[model samples]
Target: MPVVESTTRRTGGSTPHRAPGRATRPRRRQTSGLPWLLSLPALLLLAGILGYPLVRMVELSFQNMRLRELISGRPAPWVGLDNYTKVLSDTDFWAVVWRTVAFTVVAVIFTVVVGLGIALLMRRVARGVRLFMIVAMMFVWAMPQLVAAQAFRWITDSDFGVVNYVIDKLPGVDYQNHSWFVNPWQGWSVITTLVVWAGIPFIAITLNAGLTQVPKELVEAATVDGASPWQTLRSITLPILKPLLIIVTTLSVIWDFGLFTQNWVLRDGHPEPQYQTLATYSYTQAFGQSRYSLGSAISVITVLLMLGVMAFYIRQMFKIGEVD
Candidate 1:
């Protein structure tokens, strides 16, 4: 019996007297269950946050649903893509889309270029000076976008605007009554200015961080080889900063594309709404005209456009990562 028990323990860790047919190994349930188990919470959260809202939005966007429908609990009448077609056909909508694109491009250019200069400047400073510049930029970044717009409005105001007043008083300068709010292009200039100001901090902070990562060894090596300052920056520093440059540029485009407050606060929806970005166009349709379906369609289009831009950026990001 001892020999048999020892044999059983050595072979299968089972007693010799145990039922051979009935004895079973423990099964690993997680091997079968892990995917479903892990996905349960995410699926639940997605359903809770997105499922109904998206379905309802689609339904509403196809309907002539007004506040009356909410009051009566009646099924909203389906207009069957009228909202979409109308939104697409509107000249104003096209104008807004163009405006958004222009704003995004111009603002991104200035923000990235100016930000790169600032970042380069900060890179040469002592740690104390670097931190101070960063903190000051952080303050501007932290301010509300609307407040920034209003403050810019004050700065560009015809009479009280400090900038115009200063320009007017300068010798041989006939800056006379430069009503920024009146001219179409001049109004857009203010919008661009505010967007640029609001956007600089993002690119600066990002590029500054990028500058820190530029290999000192590579720069020194380049300098030792008789590379000029500009040459060193172009060949050595910029290559290292490329990834960050892409990110900062992409983000700035996305930010300025959705800008509404800068244009709106500048003129309070005046002058035939020439500078209305897509966001404000959607807002005007939804709230200003109480055209919920049309407005929702515009919202859907803007979202889709932004999504396209996001996909492009994501693809570029992956390319950068692969290169790295």
Candidate 2:
């Protein structure tokens, strides 16, 4: 007992022993500074890529910079708001804006509606069929914008096109050698069709992912309560998926607004001036006519217009969310 008591006295009782050279660790103080420091590189990269061009565009918009001034050693003269005033006063520009809006609205509506339908159908399909559909959709979505436009052009060509041949086959219908691009409206229709076809795959895939997250138990409860399919969808499915739908629709609106490649390719050499969108118009002013400042102004205005549209959609989404 004396030996045990002597040993206990020499050693610390129930306390952790530290190494000879060890010291107590200090507590970490939480601050937002670390996160900001970590994000600094990403911020700089984004500024270099996006911010630089935007600043340059704004600066160019205010200056009288044409191809001639760029070619010569002369400095670009300040034009102030002349470019903006000219664009705003042009009736043709306003016409293009309205046409672009119409096309975008129609295309978004068609894309969302068709996509929702496809997503819903996918839920009921066999696993093998679903895989095949998904693969096919990916292929369509992967198709290059220019390639799709060119394919559509070939399909709708005035001479020896499949579309004309199909129309001619219908009784009392003669569409042989019919030119789809003969008028502005017809040309715009083809463009809209191409946009809708190309856009549907993405929306469908996104919605399908959203649909998978929906509660099957809730759906079963609705079915057990004798609710019709449409009733269940409107009262349950859509409400649950509102956030996703809003996001998809907003993206569609933005994409359709700045739709350039397909439209340009489809109407390569012969887009009617009245039917031209902001993108085509800006391209004409910039590359086609060498009026750099005017083009920059138009491009700036286009961005402002799109921002306004996005703001409206965001406001509406918030309102709906609050109501729910």
Q: How many clashing residue pairs appear in each of the predictions shown?
A: 0, 0
Scored by lDDT, the top model is 2
Q: 318, model 2: CA deviation in Å?
A: 11
What is each predicted model's overall lDDT from 0 to 1?
0.83, 0.89
TM-score for all models, in order of appearance:
0.81, 0.85
Kindly report which residue pairs in candidate 2 clash with one another: none
Inter-residue clash pairs, candidate 1:
none
Tens digits of per-residue lDDT for model 2, 154-185: 89888968989998999999898898877777
Off by over 4 Å in 1: 1-55, 70-73, 174-177, 269-271, 316-324
Q: lDDT of candidate 1?
A: 0.83
Mind giving the per-residue lDDT tens digits that candidate 1 earns over 1-324?
899888987898775366758967899755677789999999999998998877777778899977677679998899998999888888888888987888788888998999999999998899899999999999999999888888988888777889888999889997666888667788777778788887888888888888878888998998999999999999988888877788878877788788877787777654257767788888888777778777788888888889977987899889978987
Q: Which candidate has the highest TM-score of all? A: 2
